[model samples]
Target: MAWFDEVAKFNTPQLRLAHITDCHLFCDIDGEYFAVNTAKHFSSALTHMAQQPLDAVIFGGDLTQDHSFESYLLFAQLIADSPLTCPVFWVPGNHDEISLMQRISGGQIKSAKRLIASGFDILLVNSKGPTPAGWVSEQHINELSEVLAASQQPAVVFCHHNPLPINGYLDKHMLENGPQLLNVLHNSGLVNHLFHGHVHNDYQFKFRSVDILSTPASSVQFTKHSIDWQQQNMGASYRLITLERLNTAEPLCVKSELIWLNE
Candidate 1:
């Protein structure tokens, strides 16, 4: 699943996307064992990304600490307040409370929806359902069917959980219906890339015909797929995606490289 990576490049023929996820911002960084100033780390990361030309920024979810209202408002403001002039899209997570986010002020939900409508048709692809378990039901699958059917530009999807299991144990936390979801995506005939969050470790893999990608959480990078939580690295980080659409009738080519906050 090695995507074409160019250390020096900017924008794309049709879209310059910035994919970030799992901010999980806390009011303070002094948690018990983990001291993660998620907001500040995210702010610094945005400082770098905002300066670059972008078609839109797509956020895979987990924007707050335990889905707090203030955290969501603050995160929404963080994006709106950024120097970026492009649209922004969001997909919810198990750590997010959708209703609270929908009510947050200053275009939290509106801005995301506008991006979905204007640019590449986005599928929210809720990965938070069955809260305790990782799963995307058949209903969401039907919605994806219609969404991809209606998309004009290449479609980009964001979800809280990865659909492809990277390892055995974490496979227990992947979309329970991952096989089905992937099958539909491969058949949808329009999806160009599928970006995900949840593993807390950055990885790229191929499942069927689509490129399956996962990003490190903005607040933590877990130890590579182990049941021992004690072994997790839990560092602060995020990613900067550089997309290049070749000047051909073919679909766009997207390659994302990491910009770690701890760096």
Candidate 2:
């Protein structure tokens, strides 16, 4: 059955995307993270997503817990078996091995830094760092600026680390070069939103005109505003982002929601 048949239709020009992050799947199917079965939750989340009409799926990173080859293989296999057949895009999180992911995905999962679709440009940037923290280098900022300069279409940027501090212990692990990156994004008049994963919580805020959003983990959710590691009872969650193409004189309407799996 078609996924969109049950949902209300919109006449406006729009693009719908599924944003699933921080799966943290281990090599074993029975592996658990903080008492929560990672593989089981991931399967449940994918099953829910299969019912949605998604133009694309974005894995914001932290795709594995043990960072094992087997874990990646399982992730790829699950996606191949699921109802989600759209193009998948991914960036490296602090825990990810980009080369291994690329090899395992067999080029089906594109490591595209920039994607143009439905009147908007999506920019994916690598924020992986030597430590658990993340940093967006000056070179990446320059590349983003160049990409934005090359196109007049509005843009949404994605990374594995939160670009702005969330006022918690996780703040120390946020993007080290956040100020520089934010400056570049704000100066670029075309950037509409910035989406990221790392904190394992759902958060939304604005940095100037650019909306900043963070999604919870597909395996487990972390307690918000805690100085220590704390797990929340919330189940696995993902984000749905829709960008509506408006008239030339009006700005594009960007809407998003956090969908959580009960099971």
Candidate 3:
């Protein structure tokens, strides 16, 4: 069965959003991981993101390394200092404490799972588990189904873990119930894109006509196809997604570009 019997049509103007993920920040200003200063890299990424004229910014997850209250404070502070004027949205990752994040954000960082922007519905799903692996609970799946059925607009889903395996050591840590999640999306017939983090590498592919995108970390880029943990010197990167509706009778078209902060 197709995900959509008839696609939602729109003639909306272009909507550009910036996506930053896997910040791995720490309470300490000088925290390091595997010899990489995560805080420094995150600052660099923030500096560059502040320069972009974005409609909104989405953090894909892993906002902190220690999941401490101070870490969340730092995340909020950094955004407050940035030149980004648009609304900010975020989902939780394995390294994040969702309640703590919500408490400290003080409405500045919205935890709403759904957003309507430029004629499209953005669905935020929480795929974080108690352990390093990932799972989507029944509650989220039900909420997603309800939201998709309620909206008559093109949709983009964002989560922390990749629903599809990337075929590396990281595969073991992917969403354990990815097939279930995929089934929900395929049945929704409304989702046009899936954006995720966790893998710490850049990847793009199509599944059932939906764009599946994975972004590199804002701290360290992981070496793909490695049997174990490996790091590359690649600088921080983020994704810029442009959504446009050329006609009122056609499906919304999406263009996503991965921007490297080092450049």
lDDT (CA) for every model shown?
0.64, 0.80, 0.79
The regions of model 1 sitting more than 4 angstroms off are 1-13, 28-33, 80-85, 108-120, 168-170, 231-235, 243-248
Give per-residue CA lDDT, model 3, range 66-161, as digits (tens).
878898888888777766667678878888887887786554566566666556777778888878789887876786787788877678888899
> Which candidate leads in lDDT?
2
How many collisions per candidate? 0, 0, 2
Steric clash pairs (candidate 3): 3-189, 4-189
User: For residues 1-263, what per-residue lDDT tens digits would candidate 2 score against the true structure?
Assistant: 21111112223367788888998989998988888888888888887887888777789999889989899998888887777766678888888998887776544465556666556667787889888899877666676787778777687888999988887778888989876787788898988689999999988888887888998899888888888878875888999988777565667677889998876
lDDT of 1 at 151: 57
Model 2: worst 10 consecutive residues (lDDT sum):
1-10
TM-score of each: 0.81, 0.91, 0.91
The deviation in Å at residue 20 for candidate 1 is 1.1
**TM-score, cand. 2:** 0.91
lDDT of 3 at 99: 81
On the 0 to 100 scale, the lDDT of residue 87 in model 2 is: 67
- Candidate 1 has a TM-score of 0.81
Order the candidates by lDDT, highest first — what do you get?
2, 3, 1
